[model samples]
Target: MTITTLNGVTLAYDDIAPPGGAQRTVLLLHGFASNRAEGWKRTGWYTAFERRGTRVIALDQRGHGESVKSHDPADYGRQNLAADALALLDHLGVGRCDVFGYSMGTRTAMQLALDAPDRVSNLVLGGVGGKLFDPPRPGAAEAMAQAMGTDDPETIENDFLKSFRHFADEQGEDRKALAASSAAVSPPLDRAALGRLPMPVLVVAGARDDLAGDPAELAAVFPYGKGKSLPGCDHFSAIPHGALKAAVLDFLDGIPDEDDFPPFE
Candidate 1:
């Protein structure tokens, strides 16, 4: 575990070097309220990437894991988070590499690619799509915030929010910090940036992911993007699916055969 102070916030990250003769390097951005260890390590994503001969760098986003916590919404934003990712890459002397971001991390990864396409060789987005900018699911964010702030469990009051609350409790996270994290970085994105992006992009979503919006709509916006759906999975369930791994690994290897792609909607 290494820490870097970015504009007064301490961000924790891990860098794993591939054994002898690495093929490529990948930067991982985990989903909201989820840290690197839980999102990538415990989930077997870290080992999977390494097995593909790629060095891995995973970071605990500010307000999560060992990174600094902030109760102020002003402390977070899409561009700000994207800048943090770039600064980390700069700190590590990483010029070009592949980037994989899931759920909330997907927003940061897309911004990173748009902000500095030269720094990224390939971009992989999971568990997100065209609905990225849609406002939080009614009271979902509030439910999450409430969950993090309370130990009483009954205070969360919303059944859908239980998992998030449970997850925060299990991770021993700061409620206010995560609450702000969920509310911040949430202004609509610069949609124009997608068409202007220079690298090939891959958007993967679960077939049953209502929260992810339309993956096909997202891919259509990118000049060089493709969307794929994993059958029989929802947003969370989509992560560990073998089909998801196969699809992503295939994309990382090279452009997929046209047949594997979703028609632009």
Candidate 2:
């Protein structure tokens, strides 16, 4: 674990190199309330990338993991979160690299690619899809915020929100910080901006992931984008699925045919 102060907040990250040094680099951004360990290492992502001889860098986003936590909603804006990633890259002296993001991290990855195109070579977005362009469901964010803020778990009526609250509690995260982040402002998705990205993009989601909508629709927005749906997986289950890792490895390696990949059991 490495500690760095960026934008007045301390951030925690891991930088692991392959046995014989790395031929390429990949940056990983985790999901909401998930740290690098829970999101990537524990999921076998670090080893997968290392086996490919790629340098792996994964960060715990602000208000999550070992990074400094803040209860101020103003501190959790989308742009600010993306900026922290950019600062980390600059601090590490990495010029360009591939990026993989899951769930909330996908939004940050998109912002980075849009704001710093030259720095990101390719992008892999998991657990997110066409819903990126949709306006926030009415009160969805508020419900999640409430769920995180409440002391009594039974009060959270929404199953989805309740699940998040339970996960936060299990992780022993700062609920107030999470609540602020949930309520933070997010940038409006711009299809025109996404279409302009020249680098290849991959979107992956579970077939049963209602939160992500259709992955193919989101992929169509990018000129060089492709989408893959995991069988019998939902948003959370899709994260650690072997098929998801295989798809990402194939995409990053520039494999032309996804059809040859075996179906997930």
Candidate 3:
């Protein structure tokens, strides 16, 4: 574990390379309520990447892992999260690289790619789908915030919110910090901006993931985007599924360096 201060927030991250050295790098952004270890390392991602001579850089986005926790809703905006990731890359002296994100991580990755396209080569989004384009459901954030803040779990009637609460408890997360982040409002995704991205993108999600909606519809919005559906998987199960890793590795293996192709017209 390494520590760096970006935007006045202390961030925790890991930088792992193969024995001989890394031929490439991939930044991993995990889902909300999950840290780098639980989301990537334990999921066999680190080992998989190491075998391929790819360096792995993963961060516990503020408030989730060993990183500094902030109970300020004003501090957890999606752009702010994305900025931290961008700053981490700059701090590491890494140039362009591939990016993979899951659920909330996908939001941050998309923001980073939009804000600094040249810094990202290939993009992989998992555990999310067409819901990416939808407006925030009214009161959903508030409900989640309430669920996290409440002392009694029984009060969380919504199964989705309850699941979040249960997961947070299991992870031993700071409920106050989670409450703040859950209540924060992120800027809506801009379809026009996404359509303009030139890098290859893969959107993968479980076919039963209602929270993500249809992966194909979301992929259609990108210039060079494709979608993959995992059978018998849902939002949670999809994260650790071997198929998810296989799909990501396959997609990444097929992409050449930026210099190998002409600018998209």
Candidate 4:
């Protein structure tokens, strides 16, 4: 793990280097509340990228993992998060790289491309779409808020377990940090800005995603983006193991086809 100061905040990240000949670099961002370790490492994404001779860097976004955490949810806004990520790349002396993000991380990547198109060579978004900001499901925000306000650790633990036990359990090393961070990044994303991003994109969602938009609607938002729904899966299940691997590989490789293109207006 490496730590760096980006925009006055300390960020934690991991860099994995493949053997011998490495061709390209990829920056992997995990979802809200999850750190880079569980997002990429435990999921075998790092290993997969490594085997393909790609150098992958995974970041623990502000308020998650080992990075800085804040009680203020406003600090986790998309614009601020995006700048922090770009600064991390600059600090590492990386000119540009492929960006892959899942869930909340996916939203961050999309915003990054919009903010610094020149630095993003390719974009891959998983488990989210532009529709999330269109007023959350009835009572959903209230529900999460109520759960978060509980002073009882048992209740908080139960809600967290129900919401993400599979991934949360795997994140034993940074569970508390991640939980705090996820809380900060929450309330989902703001959709109005997402609809206008023109970056070349790849949007992947689970076929049965309970929280995201339908594939067709999601694909329509980007003039150059395509949508792929993993077969027989839901939001979280869509990303584990085989379901997401091939789609990600295909998307990354396809970026070269649009290497010289400009974002659609």
Q: Per-residue lDDT tens digits of candidate 4, residues 1-265?
A: 8887888899898877788966999998888657887778877888889988998888888777888867665677777888888988888888889999888787788778877778888788888754655765565444444444444534554444346534454554344444444444443443555556555678888877867766556756766777777768787777775857888797787743343468898
Which regions in candidate 3 have their CA more than 4 angstroms from the true location? 255-265
Decreasing TM-score order of the candidates: 2, 3, 1, 4
Candidate 4 clashes between residue pairs 3 or more apart in a chain or in different chains = 33-182, 63-181
Give one digit per residue, the lDDT tens place, for model 1 in 1-265.
8988965578999999878867899999998878999888888888898898998999998788998888987787878888888989988889999999999899899889988999989889999877876666677766666676776876666665677777777888777888898777455777887788988889999999888977778888888888888889888788878877888888999846567769999
lDDT, candidate 2, 93-171, per-residue tens: 9999999999999999999999999999999999988888887789888888889988899988889888888888888
Candidate 1: lDDT of 9? 72
Q: Would you give me the overall lDDT of model 1?
A: 0.84
Looking at model 3, residue 67 earns an lDDT score of: 87
TM-score against truth, every candidate: 0.91, 0.96, 0.94, 0.81
Cα RMSD of predicted structure 1: 2.9
By summed lDDT, the worst window of 10 consecutive residues in model 2 runs over 255-264
lDDT of each: 0.84, 0.91, 0.91, 0.72
How far is 4's C-alpha from truth in model 3 (Å)?
A: 2.0
Q: List where candidate 4 sits over 4 angstroms from the true fold.
A: 149-161, 165-199, 255-265
Instruction: State candidate 2's TM-score.
Output: 0.96
